[model samples]
Target: MVLSSSLSHLALLVSLSANNVLAAPRPSSPMSLSMNLKRRVPEARSADDISAWAANNKLALEAKYGNTKSIAKRSSGQNLIVNQKADSSFFGSLAVGTPPVAYDVILDTGSADLWLASSDCADSACDGVPTFKASDSSTFQNKSTEFSITYGSGAAAGSLGEDVVQMAGFSVSNQIFGVCDQVTDNLLNSPVSGLLGLAFQTIASSGASPLWQTLASSNAWDQPLMAFQLTRYNNDSKATDLEPGGTFTMGATNTSLYTGDIDYNDIPDNDESYWLQTVSSITSQANSISISSGSSALAAIDTGTTLIGGPADAVAEIYSNIPDAEAGTGQLEGYYIYPCSTTVNVTMAFGGKSWAISNADFQAEQLNSNTCMGAFFSLETGSNAPAWIVGDTFLKNVYSVFRYNPASVGFAQLSSEALAMNGVNGASTPSATIGSAAATVSATAGTRDANSAVALFHSSPSTTGPIISLLAITMTMFISLRLV
Candidate 1:
């Protein structure tokens, strides 16, 4: 049976031993820990595959909940041998329980709560992928409380549990997570064993402190922040399931991964669940067509989602500016199709700073010999829903930082190394003119030092610590919409 987000609040009892409790660490100075993300792309896929997957995913979500337009809720691939370059999904390694059994999970910033397949799961969806065996870990504590979460693509139901969870060399003791005995086929087809949500705990379906919140609140790091540098595979000639995905840094920002000053946009105190920021405008750089100017539409910067989504009217307006662009019909409904040869350069601004999206990223995938699908889709909207859901399509172009103390989202130009992997030139600059009007902010290059002082931790020292080696793992997974 499908479950709503409210179902996650069911009472759960966790038993913890005194020795299993982890002590927060106090460092001499602020430091950062880094983990390598591994990209997994199904063999030989196209834009049509992604479009169909996203459409079906949306239907499943709508069926579980009511129509998104009225509910006002906040919330792919083939095996051909051709040299196909499509959008890729990313996952990273983390260990849970005692004795440290490692599992690769999708590092998602869109949702809260962490869950893994259970060893006792006999569902077909849990076949092949690694499962967490509660019996194997001496530190594991079964809460025995049942829980379920419905995703855009599918759903999973399992029991709640607590254990020592480790990632990027740091461990959080008595971390609450889910052991899923049943999962949809959409998740079963992926290489990832489960998902690790990085959003705030308020929206967690499990109604427990998210792993990131637990670490930050316990002063596990010097600063209450996490940064991501997501890589691309569309340009890689030797792209595989194990390609170098990118970097996931905790505590502090990696100055080396980004260039210039970070343009930090404050997230309103009222909306702290997701890493949300107000989008000032969206301009099509090719013809300088702008939409949603002076609009207060909130945009969620999500790493887990593969494409960009916005309100129907706003998305329709943006696509109308493109020459010969047509709205998709039938299964391709809510999407726009344009010529594959067209260079779609879209720029999105937040806090008066506009970051241009690379043409390669804008053109999601080639739908046919002549037509291609755009990455941006018209998402169903509601009163509390964010107007735009910005995903990896726009994130891969910039260095994104999510801070919790003051609660803000920051973006900076990509470094030369990041640009090289994306096969793009220098950093994207702000457009001088948008549509028929002058730009709100003047075009000027700015810079901010990454080492600037922020909040520091004053807690007790921990046995485990934080960033260094980059290890890439190989796994294959089909692309699907993961919006929460």
Candidate 2:
């Protein structure tokens, strides 16, 4: 999740070039390196599976919203990849320190601060998880800066340190990051080891520089650019969960991965960290809502978030026009639900261009033979919070670029390969094997935060709403379902 350090400081990082001048753009080689990505679909089939995800999702929401009030008072926060499993998440592996100890990390753009569980950590969250042992690495250096960060899901305390972090063919030496000595159980069960934040340093909870910035400023590449081509998976099946077709490029945009021109949009001056943009309108065949013309709402193009969340009134309006769409239940009480047969058609406007979402992405989950969860969720932060947190649900349909020099984000139609395998289910046939070649790698993605307000939902009949904290909701309601 993103934590803004200076909420009112609306400016990009100063360019680190001669005389405050920018370096010459690299010619021909826009994206110098490319690595494949993997998709991780949540196991939410049975009653036990639903209960487990609900508990985990609660922790994620807590971390996402719980620390906002205290974040400013705290001096440190980790670049974390939380452990809750949503319907879709993507991650990649990298090596750290000398001799290269391998660890899978989320390439997140939501927040900045690199962190990992350390050998010293024995918290419930670190149980049975891989730890980064500083002593084992010859080049490891302990800065001994005590650090701590709280998430809605859990909390962590550790020390700051430096080491060499390598991905694909690129490497960054003396990379500053956190080593957790203690963490809540919510983080211990993550599918990946840590997070490598890609957003600007302005939003870093610890005020640390992001991995992309360090690599861009260093001699590693000629330009400060990164691009992503996310792949999709079939929610109905789990055979291709480890498929390795999605690609991430550093240094330049991969022309081969996109069709048509890459339309760029300037990051608004008022936004502090996230690659945020003001939405002009949200349109569908049934209706069109002028978001920007009315109340002026901003949407963060976040790779870390899982769903499209916004103010309850706005989200409710979007689903209200859909035929047979209804309110959800249990953990998703505030969210929308619809018949599985209904196909959703929605588009978001930015930079005067309309980007359409695929019907394949609208299916959040098959709740039963009649009902399915809508892809969109409600945000309790009201209209003041970012109007939308557009995640993979919309990103998989477009090839995106995050550029630093000009402080802009770009988007283009997905290439034929990406389009052929676009939607909740992409590949018709599953591959039998996955290779572990360093250059050709695969990743696992996940979402730690639940999109809706946790407090609004009622716990099981036997329990008292499962309210665990003072900040959480205490209202109770009972569902007749056996395990809901």
Shift of residue 247 alpha carbon in model 1, Å? 0.7
Candidate 2: residue 329 lDDT (0-100): 62
The regions of model 2 sitting more than 4 angstroms off are 1-87, 188-191, 236-238, 270-272, 292-296, 382-385, 422-484
Worst 10 residues of 2 by lDDT: 13-22
lDDT winner: 1
Question: In candidate 1, what are the lDDT values of residues 1-484, reduced to their tens digit?
Answer: 0111221111000000000000112123433323222233334445545455546533432332221011111000000011112334544445566655556566667777789888788887777677888887888989989988766445688999988665543445577899999887555433347777778887678898877666555444455677767666665444443444555656566666777777887886557877788877778744443345422377767776656777778788778878889998876787788987777778888766889987777776566668877878776534454566787789888888888777888888889876565422212111111011000110011111122211111111110111112111111111112332
Where is model 1 poorest over a 10-residue stretch in terms of lDDT? Answer: 13-22
The TM-score, computed over Cα atoms with residue i paired to residue i, of candidate 1 is 0.75
- After TM-score superposition, the amount by which residue 357's alpha carbon in candidate 1 deviates from its true location, in angstroms, is 0.6
- TM-scores of the candidates are 0.75, 0.73
The predictions' CA RMSDs to the true structure, in order, are 14.9, 15.5
**For candidate 1, what's the RMSD?**
14.9
lDDT for each residue of candidate 2 in 1-484, tens digit (9 for 90 to 100) = 0111321110100000000000123235332322222333444364333323433342343234323111011010001111112224454445567655655555566556778888887676565556788887887989879876654445567888887665434445566788888866544333345556677787666666666665554423344566666655544355234343355666556666787787778778745476777776787645886464433476667665555665667677888878899876665666676777877888877766788887766665565667666667665432333556666667767887777767777888888866664333332212111111111111111111123211111111122111111111110100000000
